[model samples]
Target: MGIGNWELGIGNWELGIGNFFLVFLVFLVFLVFPIPPFPHTPYRGSS
Candidate 1:
């Protein structure tokens, strides 16, 4: 029982850290390659 509880605590800690790293990576990518504000159309001036 004691060993099982100790392992559960360790697993939870690792899971939390993994999720944090994933979120940080996504944020960095968005900051580096942001979407363009203007629309990319071939006929912007043509009507």
Candidate 2:
């Protein structure tokens, strides 16, 4: 059943204890130090 698989995916993603911390850690790292500044600041005096 298509609907059943969809539910399973959601359940696993939310309930499973594996990789949860890894995902959180990765997000924290990104939040702490972003690769590229969001919205991209324009160069000073360029315009």
Candidate 3:
């Protein structure tokens, strides 16, 4: 039982890390190549 729980915990941790890296990569892509129309309006409004 204890070993099973530990294995499950490790699996969850790996999944969480994978998801976090995926999101980070997407964010970097958007930052590097932002959609012109999408960001223009918001930037103008904020500034």
Candidate 4:
């Protein structure tokens, strides 16, 4: 491996896997927030 393991494992590595988790969390939030075609549009129920 180069300096550390070339692949990521669940153990404590020199390059923190927390960074990976932080990015993944941000990505998940991004996916969840922008799904609606019109996010600001209010609900018009049962017309």
Question: How far is each candidate from the true structure, as Cα RMSD in Å?
Answer: 15.4, 10.9, 11.1, 12.2
What TM-score does each of the candidates earn? 0.45, 0.40, 0.48, 0.39
Better of 3 and 4 by lDDT: 3
Question: After aligning candidate 1 to the native by TM-score, how far in Å is the CA of 7 from where it should be?
Answer: 20
**Stretches of model 4 off by over 4 angstroms after superposition:** 1-14, 35-47
- Which stretches of model 3 miss by more than 4 angstroms? 1-11, 36-47
Off by over 4 Å in 1: 1-11, 36-47
Q: Model 3 residue 31 lDDT?
A: 70
Give the C-alpha lDDT of model 4: 0.48
TM-score of 2: 0.40
1-47: candidate 1 lDDT, tens digit per residue: 33344455577877656665665675465467654763452334342
User: Is 2 or 3 the stronger prediction by TM-score?
Assistant: 3
Candidate 3, residues 1-47: lDDT per residue as tens digits?
33344555567988656666665775577677786767654334665
Candidate 2 error regions (>4 Å): 1-15, 37-47
Candidate 1 has which clashing residue pairs, if any?
A: none
- Whole-model Cα lDDT of every candidate shown, in order: 0.54, 0.51, 0.60, 0.48
Question: Cα lDDT for residue 46, model 1?
Answer: 48
* lDDT (Cα, 0-100) at 25 in candidate 2: 68
